[model samples]
Target chain A: MTPRPQQEPTCHGEDYAPFERALLNDYQHELPLVPRPFAAIGEQLGVSEQAVLEALQRFREQGVLSRVGATLKPGAVGAATLAAMGIPERDLEQVAAIVSARPEVNHNYEREHELNLWFVAMAADDAALRAALTAIENETGYPLLDLRLVCDYHLDLGFDIQWTSANETDA
Target chain B: MDVSERDRRLIGALQAGLPLVRRPYAVIGEAVDMSESEVLRRIAALRDAGVIRRFGVIVRHHELGYRANAMMVWAVPEHQVDSLGERVAESPQVTLCYRRRPAPPQWPYNLYCMVHGRDRETVLAVRDELVARHGLEGMEHRVLFSGRRFKQRGARYLAPKQEAIGREANHGRA
Candidate 1:
């Protein structure tokens, strides 16, 4: 993999209001499954239903929230694999575009490693997954490292962000 | 479990996102031409059937002050991976953990775990503790911090016809 500059954390500073932060940190993992979920959130948070809806809308618009929906378990509905490819620097963008062009490819990232171009592909079944991987390998001309997940543990991406340095540890 | 055409449409609409409104189901039903009750019923059925995992807020970790994130891979003995993976995942600091196929000759790490924290140092500390606790001191491993995220989105599991249309669009662009 072509050596790229190490990435610094881009997300910093607490610019959001207290309610927004509370909504983000607390209500992220579980949104009540109700006819008026936002209303429930509002009732608990001491905010109006309209205020909760507006805050969520703003959060989604600002990229603070990806969505208000279900995170389908990998391999639950179909076959999926975490794949990586080692592409030459010159062909990185070309290869990445080719890989990302597939609709099944949900996540594509550039990591710091020899097998740089990493992505996750999901399809209707095993046959479709194999076909997609084979097509990507054939197009990119790079041997794909297909890593099927054996098991997922603690895969929750959402966590309570401690604004204070409560659990801060030295490097 | 087969999903009806209307249910497929609901899934497609939901994959995009549920609206932040008082009557979200009603709003979504209006868009998908389904009744509010029908949409609610279908969603419940989908959740029960395991098609939809859990309806919740998809938080952006980075945006929410999780600055440092590393995908750490370790080459553990094949037999020990399952047990070690469970132990490592029990830590709150380790957000994701799994056993993946190792790329031989170059990459020989089958066990992978993601550690996310407010800073690089915090993440590193967590990693060190995990390594020491798991007795993975002598193991060959590497921490690959995410440099740039090109794309991140929900997995699209629409109807086969919608999948075909998506492929066609991508092919046209290519």
Candidate 2:
């Protein structure tokens, strides 16, 4: 892992308007499944439909919000597994690029360990998943640790944003 | 449960995200040649079928100041995994929890959960509380803090080439 840098903690919410904060904090899930969903959200947020739409657009452009869409259950539409590889420090970048380029590989990270490069691989089926992992192994010339999930105990609730802690509101 | 061809098209259209328009479903319907009502119905059906686990705003935690995260893995007794995993997952501090196949002789930790906080000290404190609260003190565990993130994006169930383009267009990351 990269050593933790000594720096002042950034207050991410310093620039966000209350409406923007509410949109992010309150709507992580349970979006109204309606023809005019944004309008519905606007009703709850006490803003016009246009305001809601405009705010989301800005959030997207700023990369603060990923999307307003479905998060598919892992292995529901396809097979998936958590995979890791022990890449030599010198070659981590090259090997990581290869893994990241493959769209099948998602959530790739360099962790603080011998098996540093970790990622999640997904495909249409078990066979396709194996083939993808095998190709990565052959290309990278490193054995992969295929950790298939046995159970997902965490409910699908979205991550709760600690708004007060994340912001310097008093300042 | 098989996903229909139309459902696949819907998923493809949605992989980017719902457009920030008044009638976003109408926009999506136009893309897949689905009626606005039909699109909404399909989305609900998909959700009910457990295909769509969540449907709403997806925030980037790192950008939101929940930067420090650690993947905590524990090797608990086989019989106690289900009970312990449920407890760990129930903790609000733990963002993700799963029982994974442990690579034995080398990696013997099967239970996995992730804790995220604004900084390292907060993350470690959360882990400690979880460990103590769950009676997992004696268990063999390791906390693997995340380092450089190479790539992070939503799962691409469709062709990689197509979704990669859409991913970049939407700035999509999980």
Candidate 3:
């Protein structure tokens, strides 16, 4: 299929206001190590265990919630990274299929610009991840511009759309 | 927020905690006074809506011994972003890929994507393939690897009217 220029906002729900940002917030604490943690939270929210369960179902039913499982730090357990590519218009689909077929690749996105492709890599470690990149380079005949993360001034995004760092003088 | 009362109770519990026992549903039933089957059905509904993305283990990459990681950003041609994105994300190495309004002047590329691997070498190999396969010869990309992890966890689900509950999403893993 012929690819066309398109912009997809991942932070969708722009058409309609988010039902409540709070529901998506508050993961700072450890998940209840015990069984029936939901029951515990239900007591605090002044609702029934059933209510908590169903509400999550509904948020997911709507496009508000993304996942209800644990968010483990991939870096600690394994290795991962982010990268992008510059593909021609005609061969994007073929490339996408090939890329997704790999186990290491995960997040993928399309943008509007010269280097219009971007994605994240979560491999078991640095060597493995680099090896994967090399294999890709060999197949595609293009050197990947590896821009490793230097510092993350802001890591936790999305939840606090209105959050501002202490050094808000510049923006 | 607009869920039925029954749903409210179920969600409330889920938001608080999920049973980690063999019969998690049974424990949940005791709290909400519903059958395990009922709880499972409700979860299925949420997943269908793209709200509850899934019920799986949140992997701790570093703990799993994966040290090298970066946020690889790409700059594909505007016409090929979608197809390219699908391909880039196709690799299980990638965890996220969508679209972002690139920062002007500072950030030239608009199309953003990701790929995760064991180390820098593995990731670079896959990236190189895309570069050549897609014919991206002259493009800028940054593979920003993480040195410190401030926080990371499942996305919080807050309604529009409520105050977002901010928690320290990621704990120490060093």
The whole-model lDDT of each prediction reads 0.75, 0.82, 0.48
lDDT of 3: 0.48
Cα lDDT tens digits, model 3, B1-174, are 134556545543454234333346555555666887787776565544433443432333443234555566666566766676666655544555554434444465555545555578976887788777766668777665644332233322222111011111111110
Question: What is the C-alpha lDDT profile of model 3 across A4-115, one tens digit per residue?
Answer: 2333212222322232222334432233333465566566566666655565554444434444453332232245555656677576555555555554555554544455
Candidate with the greatest lDDT versus the true structure:
2
TM-score to native of every candidate shown: 0.83, 0.90, 0.44
Looking at model 3, residue A38 earns an lDDT score of: 59
After superposition, which runs of candidate 1 have C-alpha atoms over 4 Å from their true positions? A1-14, A155-157, A164-171, B1-10, B30-34, B41-51, B163-174
Separate DockQ for every predicted complex = 0.49, 0.63, 0.04
What does candidate 1's lDDT look like per residue over B36-138, in tens digits? 8887888888877866766777777776667677899999999999999989988877767888877777878989998778788988898899988889999
Ranking by lDDT: 2, 1, 3
What docking tier does model 2 reach? medium
For residues A42-145, write the lDDT of model 1, one tens digit per residue. Answer: 89888988888787776665676887877766666668899988888798888888988887788898878887889998886788989999999998888888
Better of 2 and 3 by DockQ: 2
TM-score of 1: 0.83
